[model samples]
Target: MTKFIIALAYKLETSIKYKRFKEFTYNLLENNSYPYKKHFDTAMIFLVLSTIGILIFEVNHKNLRILNDYELFAVIIFVIEYIGRLWISSDMHKIILDDYEKYQLLNKKYKITKSIKKIISKKVDFILSPMAIVDLLAILPYYRPLRLLRILLIFRLFKILRYANSLKEFLQVFKERKFELFTLGLLYITVVFFSSTVIFLYEGPEGVNPNIVDFFDAVYWSIITISTVGYGDVTPITIEGKLVTLVLVVSSFLVIAFGTSIITTGLSDRMEIIKENRVQSETSKMQDFVIVCGFGMMGRYFCEELLSIGKKFIIIDNDKEIVNSAKSLNYLAIHSDATNMQTLEMMGINKGANSVVALTNDDAVNLSIVLSARAINENIKIISRVNNGNSRKKFDIAGVNQTIIFNDVAAFVASEYLGQPVAFEAIDGILLNKDFDVIIDEVEILDNSKILGKDINLVDFKNYNLTLLGIINLSNMNNFIFNPTNINYTVQKDDILIIIGFKASISQLKSDLINLDFRV
Candidate 1:
């Protein structure tokens, strides 16, 4: 009894370990993370392609030893993968657990034997699943004693469909329109069968027509006429045969048109669903991504800058034309109202979004969007574009983290250019010049950063080829000390450090700061 108990405990502990292993394996196989999962997936893709190539070569050169060796190697890998999947089938454990709970509830007793049986039954069910069966069949060809089983190797190609997003979408389209497609297929078969029978009866051996000597000839002629190919290899020489041919040729166009219409409509609908699914998948995988709540001129400029900097973002616009324009530029865009809470939720603002920018050109709409976004995610950073000076206070009151006054900024630029043309031009050249090697950006200090309690002089910004501009203290939101005279000023938590440097230098500085545990 002690030995049995110890064995059971060990098995349970191993099962728990297997569950964790399954999760890790799933992430490695399915997720798009670089090097780890990506390397595995690439290797698997190469193996699959190699197997297919071997199969093709085997068909042409029947007894190639190299082909057999490659096939054996691929089959071994597939068999190992299949076994790993089965061993980590956590769903089977869930099924067994659920069944055991139900049994205890019904009988008011704990039966180890019954629970074990239930587990075995679930395992059997898993083995018989469609994918599992495919995995098993994919390996059967290696057992060459069954010569007929070699054909089952072709099914290995079907396994690739599991990893293909577009193929899955196509399969979904077919599934959704199966009934319509089935009806059209039936109609086509009926038309072909009836037309062939009538043509054969009218132009067969007893008939006046000599060209169509058999039923198959009449069938072939009907197919050709229906498709409007009109090979003209066989033609009716009698009035009855000609009349039947005319009716079939005319109805064939109608059938073809109807079928085309159904397919076109179904495909359009399925494509839309696929696009939405793709968007959702992308958004789900994103963390710390920006959300641009309009795709106007200002929004477009922001997206362009973000893209140049390699930042991930999604654009939401009410105008379909603007959304399409954004999409044309390869931006992830959704045609929806920026102020709607449901729209923000669908955009995953509460989940993985780092910031939300409202640039709708309407102060009221921007305010609403800011408020809505804050309600959904209190911690999310909110930035809005304010056209009117009066709306700036309203936006601040609505919890907007930042507001850009375009009119004021434009006026200031104009006045600065007029008063000090050379200085203004030099500044503009540095700020607006995309070709400039160095640029300025802000990096926020986190509470846990090593530089938090240290003075500015302690850290060597010059070492990284970065020039210290100033620091904006978050504690006093409006306090920005530019080019501070004091070199011993202590860096505080949540301080935004403004630094200017070359791209590589800035990247190195950012990495160093992040390594020291800076927030942004």
Candidate 2:
């Protein structure tokens, strides 16, 4: 039976109509970058709000019978959405086919039953997930009775949480801190139950103070007192009752303070996560961004220079305040330890990070960052700050491309990177002295560069007053054609051109390279 079902699923997946429909549905509901996803989300949001608004009106205001069709339509759409989420949550045909292929490769019989079980488990996992649960609850109102209507309608209102990213983030903050909140809740429940029981026993109809008529009344009084919302309706007259009331009042302060602290901590954590996520997304979009692994005075100055030069970079620091300060200037900075391997991975050192700059105060931390970044990407350029002269060799041994220290000089820009010999001292002297009009820089030949498919000698470097230092092919990192006079040294994509010239000349050269005419 499972074999037959798998075969049918394979056939369905192979059908072009089914494939196209599934692809479109998945893109509409699941793809963040899909152009029409915003439209789908907006429509869903409007439908949810409109249906909920109608439900509200049915409860109190005059009947708007004409809008009943829209409410029914919304419920149907909610049902479709729930099924769509379940469908896209896993590809059953792919799972079965993959398992079958793996078994064939392993020279073992295919476990058809096992693959069937896996598909069921995947579907069950999605159904049990929080968002799926919300989707189900939103649809449940359609099947519910009028008296139970409002309760289920609230869940339909919560349907907006799926369409809204901010509300999901807000929900995530509390979800991450559930354990702490749960611990506090246990304390609260204990106090409320104990006080309610005692007050009921002391001030019930049997007691001299009979204002607390029953257990229900005592429970109400307990909640009001503990929250410090005192009402004269259920006053405690007896001495025992008064003592319990005093204890409840004091307990409210502790609970309120503790809860406030927990929420504040969660918010801080969520904000940090949001900032890191933003940096990660930016890295995925940018191919040649630098990772600066410190935000100290030196690090800050280095980043400032990078910004002034129009270079893309992200900042990593253990200091929360420093990260916040960097963010204030609209820099892509994350509060993270640069020495951690996982943190370096998060910053995309292995992906497309062009280089890493470690400018931390501590020599050991800087060395650790160098080692971590090198471990992730051996070819990635790493420059570390060496405050102590003795620690310079340690950084070199860890495969740092360069070591720099800032005394009165603010920053170090590496002119020589990964053994492509452009004089470091010359560039350093230019920036440090701030007296030289000449500056050394590098420009990468992109796929769309005007000079691509042309010989290296085509564009006259002397015309721009820019000396062609060398061209490093990114693919062949070990090879550098220094001052290549060869006619065949053609301009190609991913070639880094190191040159020395004025800033304006370099910028103009870059602009020309991408445009149709780079002939200077």
Candidate 3:
């Protein structure tokens, strides 16, 4: 019984360890798993590039012992990464659970052994997958006999294909135009063969010309003439051979031009499609992510605030240059009209979006976006930035939840700065201080929260180093109780708690308030 207990404890420990390991691997490797994935991918890219550089140096400097050592170090890192990935292959726990279920159907005596074998088989299948095969080849150079297989190490560079969206799009272009590319290949080959044969027939020893001796020489001369790389060494002495060369040269140019045009057109179309698909896929995976239409100064500032609060968001703008600028800063942005319903649908505004913020300089454009977003997602919160006060009524009529008037806000801020300089600076210090650890944020109390039915005065916010600034009752919409002295006030579901504290403490409190057992 003691032995059985120890075995059970060991199994529980291993299961916990496996869960942690899987989570870490998923965040490091999977897109949308974490916010810092770009940094991780960039670091891996540099590491791979360094390994490739070392391999190139090793090829030229055979006697350099340090190069060999560097290569070994790279190989060790690759091996560890490969092993970790294999251990946490997709649906690892599911596979084990499936095996356990099958074992339960068998005789009780053979359950443990059969379950073990089944689990091993599933893992072996994962190891034999195409990606796993490449990973194995990447580390095979460690073996003495397979040291020559180090040349295959170059293929390891292709591993980056998984991380690079552009490379994936390039490959997709080729895949989509495979038939056209094949036809082009066949045409080029046929032309080269026919030209080589005809040139040999016209300029061979039996012919009128004696310059070309063999079929290979004729073929070499044909290639040079057609490619416009005339060497003049194996020139056609006969008029017939020269005429044939001219025809081949012209045909080659036509074929080359045709092929180039086809590839260019195909790639352009495929790239656009890939970009759309990528945006759709990323947005679909996100829940409660904000959609910022018009990547102008206001939209940019909103994105900065959202990112500071660790929120996911996508920026949309009709200007390609602005879209590119946002992408340069690692923000997921697309160049497209926000006012169009099709564009809104493509951006997943009707799906997992928490809210839509229209911040275009043009009030008309922002109003159109607000209307379209509300039409698509009736429940989605629509916020519009208005330059004109008259636009606020139109936005409200279109079901916009809020409207920010730039002129009025600017005027208010300026007035406050002039009248209450000290108070303005104090608030600004908390809101804009670069090194300040604390800031004010709002957290909604969900129905399942432990403190939902409790009184505000009973809860010890000071224990968490957080101070309650106010609470906004969503049921009564505009009702806000700021620094309430009422000890009998009870917290209700969907009550927005405006709190000020360190970012970490605020995040923890928010997590506690919305403690729903859910998975991403």
Candidate 4:
């Protein structure tokens, strides 16, 4: 039974792209980027307000025609949003796009179209899954008026929230410690059942609401009280019944506390394992990725830099808590000592990394990573973070690519903050933290844009207050001309301009490019 619960949680989390959907939702909240950002926010707000409004209408004597209408509108919008989410889900190709290419890989050797069809055709179970049943019930069109049953629709939020990393961790822990939870749950049930049976026999005839003529009513009241929810609709009038109720209430609290503790410990352990597995899986598939061996303040800065430039990287750390934290931020991270060769290999360090940044506070651990990496793949670039500036040359002699002394970098940047305002601000915003006013936009030149025929130098970028960081083309996405001196390169259609500027400025630039006159 515990295994079943854990399996369900696993399917909802690791098997689905729930994490990405949360990110997509967050990205949707960004000021500019996607098409449906504003509409999405509007729908969310409407849903919240509508739910509260209708719930009040149901409970109190509030006039609810306007509220009902709004709730209906919100539900309709939510249906559309839900469908869109399903379509955009990672397995969406299987759900809707039934094309041969859907099953075909980049390499033709791994074709599983036949296997996929066979599995889909042979499906037997339909009504067993609670979530599947919930999805079916939510769209059944039977709950037009506000009903208690309709409130179950709120469970749809879990369909989305289950994908979130923190939620996923909770689910994982619940599963890993299901057996203990189940045992405690059984004990709770026994206590409730025994108490209810005794109450029904002892004092049911004397209560005001003696609906406990049968065993079921006694059981229901016991469940309600044990769950710490006394609705006041049912109560005991007899002294014997009231005494039993008091004991049940106190025992319920103790049972709940015990169960919570068990779940917390189970979740912590399972979360660490899940986090490690997630990082390893992601890193295994990544190519030309950077391996960051630590998640300290410095490692976070390094990650933000890579994220700004849209580089692939995985973080490795010995601290399980830090690794889990990184995982929650949607970063791939392994909770293992970076000095270990096995940990490095598991992270695909030997096979796919373009570079490895050893940034753990301990100089010995960082050097060990450099030495181990050198042994595994001498060609792989190693950037070691040095605590003591004097150990820089030793790491250099040990084949480390670059030794960064963080204190010196911080001091230099701090000093420059006074002398060079723009450069310092830009550096601080893009490097130190992710919550900043800067964005990296990759704009493609359309055939109709006026800049297409003009030379890069003559584009009047000075008036626009923008800078061209690099140019990328159809052939290569990574290779870019960074700080190119020559500006005579003619822009063409489909050429990608990797530019960094204030988001508003870039948005205006894109709008201006779209409005440019062209005769073709």
For candidate 2, the per-residue lDDT at 446 reads: 89
Q: Which pairs clash in model 1?
A: none
Instruction: Tell me the whole-model lDDT of each prediction, alpha carbons only.
Output: 0.80, 0.82, 0.79, 0.71
TM-scores, one per candidate = 0.68, 0.67, 0.58, 0.44
Best by lDDT: 2
lDDT of 3: 0.79
Candidate 4 lDDT by residue in tens digits, 400-427: 9788997898788778987999988766
Q: What is candidate 4's CA lDDT for residue 377? A: 85
RMSD to truth, every model:
6.8, 7.0, 12.2, 13.7
Candidate 3 per-residue C-alpha lDDT over 184-298 given as tens digits, one digit per residue, 9 for 90 to 100: 8888878888988988877786766666888898888877876778888888877888888889989889888978988899988887667766776688778889999988899
Put down candidate 1 lDDT per residue, 1-520, tens digits, no spaces.
4346435545665686776777787676555332265466557667877787776766767677877777788888898888776766645445545555676589865455665676677678879988788878888778879667778877777777655656767777767888988998898889999988988887786656777888898989888999999988888877887898899988899899988898788788788667766776678778889999988899999999898777899998989899889889989988778899988987889888899999988988999999999999999999999999888999998999999998998999899999999998888788779888767888788765677777767667767777889989878865999875365688888888898888898777667665773332
Question: lDDT by residue for model 2 over 311-367, one digit each (tens)?
Answer: 999898999898889999999988888999998887778776899999988999998
Q: How many clashes would you count in candidate 1?
A: 0
Model 3 weakest 10-residue run by lDDT: 511-520
Ranking by lDDT: 2, 1, 3, 4
Instruction: Rank candidates, TM-score, best first.
Output: 1, 2, 3, 4
